[model samples]
Target: MNNQIKLSKEKREDMIALIKAYFLKERDEELGDLASGFFLDFITENLAADFYNQGVWDAYTYMNVKIEDLLEIQKY
Candidate 1:
């Protein structure tokens, strides 16, 4: 099973820019394109799954609540 998170080219560029911005603003250091890209790739490869799983869990909980409400509307 491939767990790697594949982002679109536009999204990847956006993320790289965001990472560079964060470093410049927060760390007072400028990150080059290669460094920012490597950072983004590392995050995508290593940390994205945790975030994705959390989103899935949140969606599941929300759906369960909606399903319960749906059952309450049934005529019996």
Candidate 2:
């Protein structure tokens, strides 16, 4: 069992940046190829093992969080 480790704001921001960079990089690439290589190159990569080691398996958990934040956005 893994104990939950608290992340500093800076650390959390860094992890978010890492995720964005990864997605942006793959955005222009072939989805099929990237999907096939994702398991090893992204999933098992050092960033995964070091930070997001738990893996984001809960789709709704992620989606709801995003939706909630988006809903809170104020349109000028």
Candidate 3:
């Protein structure tokens, strides 16, 4: 199973822009495309999996609740 998360080109650009803007706003450091791209890569490679796993867990919990509700309705 492929665990790699893939973003569309537009999404990638948007994220990069957001990263650049965030650093510029909060840190007062201007990040160029190369720097921001590297930062994005680092986040994507290292941190995204953790976030993705959390999302998967959240979805599982949500679906479980829905399934329980469905079962309850059937019991009525």
Top lDDT prediction, candidate number = 1
Q: Estimate the overall C-alpha local distance difference test score of candidate 1.
A: 0.93
1-76: candidate 2 lDDT, tens digit per residue: 6544555767655555565566669775333434444433544444554555345546658888999999888797
Q: Name the TM-score of candidate 1.
A: 0.93
Q: Model 1: how far is 37 from its true place, Å?
A: 0.9
Q: Would you list the clashing residue pairs of candidate 2?
A: none
Whichever of 2 and 3 has more TM-score, that candidate is: 3
Question: In candidate 3, how many clashes are counted?
Answer: 0
Ranking by TM-score: 1, 3, 2
lDDT of 3 by residue, 1-76 (tens): 9877788999999999999999999999999999999999999889999998999999999999999888876642
In the predicted model 3, the residue pairs found to clash are: none
Worst 10 residues of 1 by lDDT: 40-49
Question: Clashing pairs in model 1?
Answer: none
Once fitted onto the true fold, the runs of candidate 3 whose alpha carbons sit more than 4 angstroms away are none
The TM-score between candidate 2 and the true structure equals 0.33
The 10-residue segment of model 3 with minimum total lDDT is: 67-76
For candidate 1, write residues 1-69 as lDDT tens digits.
Answer: 888888899998998899999999999999999999999888888888999999999999999999999
lDDT of 3 at 34: 91
